[model samples]
Target: MVDGKGKKMSKSAGNVMAPKKIIDQQGAEILRLWVASENYREDIRVSNEILKRLTESYRKIRNTFRYLLGNLNDFDPVKPIGYR
Candidate 1:
């Protein structure tokens, strides 16, 4: 529904990003950061060039998480912390 005018992000458009795609390529963290980086009120565009640049930062985050997980391999948590 482009009347030569830009539209906003919506669930009805069916242009929503798929979870499986995100998990397959970079992982959940990348998708989360990408979503967090944008302003929801404005239109969000997805092009290969943009995704390419974003995925770099995404991969870095994923790598950092991986490293942290590896470093904490031996540690085990007895229970999860609850926020007050």
Candidate 2:
């Protein structure tokens, strides 16, 4: 894995980022999204900026879903409304 600045992660280098800490601060969903978005064939880079971006993306998707669902508050499945 690589650091956000693209440097190799190392113990002695003091650049290791703990997963538990990230999970506690950002939630596991964000981490999962980050992994799924990366190309795995190369070194994975981690940084505050990347996590922040992912969080924003997650929020956008979640908010969009919430908005779409919110509009269906009065929806009736059995009595579907016909389009005008």
Candidate 3:
């Protein structure tokens, strides 16, 4: 694992990123998405750039869901709504 500064996370180096801290700031879902999106075949860097991009992605995902839900609020399951 690596720190936000791109340094290897180590206890001796005092550069470890605590899970609780990250969860508290960015939420566990974001952390999970970050981990799941990474390619485990190689070393991963957890820098500010990566986090920023992930945050933006998460926002987009959330907005998409919100838009879907909002648009579906007036739809009835018994009747099919034709796509325009």
Candidate 4:
């Protein structure tokens, strides 16, 4: 594990990040998403910068879903709408 500054996370170094802390602050879903999104083929870096970017991406995804749902609210299921 690596800290936000790219330093190796270690108990001796007092830089280890507690899982509970991350889950508490960002939720379990965000933590899971971060792990799943990574390649995991090599050393993984966990930093505030990475988390910030991931949070921003998650927000964008939520906004996109909201926009799509809002636009579809006016559509009628009984009548198929023609797409351009």
RMSD of each: 9.3, 1.6, 2.5, 2.2
- Tens digits of lDDT, candidate 1, 1-84: 121134443568755456677567767666667667766675666534555678898778779999999998876588675679
Q: Which candidate wins on TM-score?
A: 2
Provide the global lDDT of candidate 3 against the true structure: 0.81
How does each model score on lDDT? Answer: 0.64, 0.93, 0.81, 0.81
lDDT of 3 by residue, 1-84 (tens): 876555788889877767687788888887898899987886776755777789899999999999999998888889976889
Q: List residue ranges in candidate 3 displaced over 4 A.
A: 4-6, 77-84
Instruction: List the candidates' TM-scores in order.
Output: 0.46, 0.86, 0.76, 0.79
Model 2 segments more than 4 A misplaced: 77-84
Q: List the residue pairs that clash in candidate 1.
A: none
Poorly placed runs, candidate 1 (over 4 Å): 1-36, 76-84
Tens-place lDDT digits, model 4, residues 16-69: 767788889887877887898876886677876787788888889989999999
Cα lDDT of candidate 1 equals 0.64
Return the clash pairs for model 2, or none: none
Q: Positional deviation of 56 in candidate 1, in angstroms?
A: 0.8
Specify the highest-lDDT model's number: 2
Query: What is the lDDT, from 0 to 100, of the residue 26 in candidate 1?
Result: 65
lDDT of 4: 0.81
How far off is model 2, as Cα RMSD? 1.6
Candidate 3: count the clashes. 0
- lDDT: which is higher, 1 or 2? 2
